[model samples]
Target: MAKNILIVCTSWDKLGDTKEPTGCWAEEVIAPYYIWKKHGYNVTIASVKGGEVPMDEASLNPPYLTKEVEDFLLDDEAMKGLMDSVPLSDVKGDDYDAVFLPGGHGTCWDFPDNAELIALLSHFVDYNKVISAVCHGPMGLVNVKGTDGQPLVAGKKVTCFSDAEEVAVAKENVVPFMLETRLKELGALYECGPEKWAPFALRDCNLVTGQNPASSARVADLVVDALTWK
Candidate 1:
């Protein structure tokens, strides 16, 4: 059977207190979604709440907007999937071989403390299956506890949207907290690329992570490699 992949997205749409709209970065989800489909994997999109995941408006413009995202905007099937995503509460983690969390500023508001998200990640941990995230997606990993009752990221080699990148984007003060600092606080052996906004991805055992929107395809490729060779 083709491997089943569950993609969890953020439901929150606002950028902190600002009126600026934001959710999953279009490239983050669009790039990886097509990659998984190309590999013949079954992909299901879900969110903290069911239905209508918002794409960060800025991601639709230059720099962040890529061919994959442009294609996604024109694909009715993909649009329907995003518009009618399943609620995380309705998903059973066992049904998937891997779980991927794609990110944007919206994740800062909703991912960290979600009970359903934590429980689903726990299932992936218990089964020793792949758990992957990119950019702000790693925020979902921060609060997850391992079998030893420690933060799941503790001692694991991982990377996410760096603190420097946040400052570069001028959202350092706007986001809830610094992801790099939080990961380190949780004892993650966090790593990043040589510079900000680069394609950086790391696979430490079954835990895979990418640093930014630019690293989405790299993260998906790593997950595919892991699944193929396991």
Candidate 2:
């Protein structure tokens, strides 16, 4: 049977605070898409909202941009998927085997406060389905609560965009709370990469996480594995 996945990406940015326009990393979303699509998985693109996805122009240019992203942009099918993404309110865990959230500061603003996102994640976690996130995408987990009324991430090992990386880009001073600190407060035992852009990931049962943009593809791969596990 073909595996199915729900891919979530960020579409929010706040100008100077971002230093650069930031959206879901193309590599993180594209690489994973290629791998899973090749292996015959049905992938769905969704956002906090259900309209046009705002891409980070900076991440789509130069060394960061690759053949895959260019192809994805040119692929009308995929482009349509991005442009008319489903709203989180419509995504149900039973409809997909896995759920993946690619990262960006945009997610920090959008993912955390979305009630629909919280419900979707709670459904995935409750059913033992794979739920994964990369970089700031893990911010989506902030409000997800299990049926027990406990935070779904509580006591789980996870990773996301590090405070160190945010500081290097000069947003640490202004951003309210740090991701690492917030996760800690939720009782999540967070782990991260040794350096800013390094790839780091965690798999605590059904919860999967990645440290930063570099960890995106790997994070998706692990999620696929977790979902396809027998």
lDDT of 1 at 19: 90
Which residue pairs in candidate 1 have backbone atoms (N, alpha carbon, C) closer than 3 angstroms, thus clashing? none
For each candidate, what is the lDDT?
Answer: 0.94, 0.81
Over 7-102, each residue of candidate 1 has an lDDT whose tens digit, in order, gives 999999999878988898888888889999999999999999989998888899997779888899899998887999999989998799999999
Q: TM-score of model 1 relative to the true fold?
A: 0.98
How do the residues 1-230 of candidate 2 rate in per-residue lDDT, one tens digit apiece?
88889998766755436565666667777878888888889999988777777777767899778888999989999888778988777777798888898876677777887777877888787887888888878889988886678887888898988888888877686555688889989999988877789889999988899988778778877877786673
What is the TM-score (0 to 1) of candidate 2? 0.92
Looking at model 1, residue 198 earns an lDDT score of 86
lDDT of 1 at 195: 83
Residue 225, candidate 2: Cα error in Å is 1.9
